[model samples]
Target: MNKILRSFTLFTALSAASVGVHAGNYWTASAQDGWIDGYVEATLLLSGNLDASGIDTDVDDGTVTLRGKVETDIDKALAQELALGVDGVIGVENMLTVFSPGDNDDAAKQRKLTDEKVATVVKTRLMVAPNVTSADIDVNSTKGVVVLQGKVKNDAEKQRATEIATKASDVEKVVNKLSVSE
Candidate 1:
């Protein structure tokens, strides 16, 4: 019984550390969303039941929006299930399109992959940008076109986000829909 308790404690500590939480430190809203995003991505990638390469996850207020393509409807359902299983996720918006090989050729698959990559890169760049508050920003991509949505501090931040997104590889255009908060 003592050994089991010790192991459980260790596991809890590791889990907390994995999510960037330390003792006596609370998770901010943005931190929680970041953790949820990473958790959902990891969960889908590790599921082994789905391809996950074309998937992109965005978390806002505990709701996860899953975008991109999957080979089958089952894969789409599985991705949503896996995302909903994450501890902080309250809802899942499955925007995953079912890829029909007969309808889509290799070029289509490549375009989907490129879109996923663009979204990921843009989101990552926004998150790391010092002047950008990326927590409220949501990134989406379709066929190399990137869309930025949500709120930012000011026009500068919004423009900075657009510039950052436009710099991502394979981004043909950036449609900025970010509203400036008063």
Candidate 2:
């Protein structure tokens, strides 16, 4: 009885600790995540052996994205339902795809190239954007292609800036480093 009680206490303590670590707006871009602690816990439980241990869910904004590996379709469904039930998750975009147990490098490489292409396209699009002045938009590139940094009027403008910067081009990815106020 003592051993069981001790184990339960430990589990509770660890769960609380995980939530404490992810209580900031630094994880994602939406505003709803700040109030959804249970969502984070649900995701952690459903991750099974999938390794998203570092995946932060403390995004002060509402945007919550959950990524991990699941062996069975049932597990996937449960995780999705739990994620959707979370307070701040307006949408749950499944990027998990499927992961075969064996070694796979093709998908990884493709992701790199796609990210680069997105960056390139986003850069080109932003350069010619209607209200955007490219001179102020600092763009950076890695294997992923583009990362935008600067300030914009609002989220709409920021999104537009990202869109113009990441249009269908050679770019593989576009990182919106842009900031917004009102």
Write down the TM-score for model 1: 0.45
Indicate the TM-score of model 2: 0.31
lDDT per residue for candidate 1 within 4-118, as digits (tens), equals: 9999999999998877764424457778899879977876775544689999999998999999988875567667766765667899999998875333345765566455555
* lDDT of model number 2: 0.54
> What's the TM-score of every candidate structure?
0.45, 0.31
On TM-score, the leading prediction is: 1
Predicted candidate 2 versus true structure: per-residue lDDT over 41-135, tens digit per residue: 54445443333443334433444455656554333443444455444566665544344444334665445434433443344445546777555
Candidate 1 regions with alpha-carbon error over 4 angstroms: 1-105
Backbone clashes in each candidate structure, one number apiece?
A: 0, 29
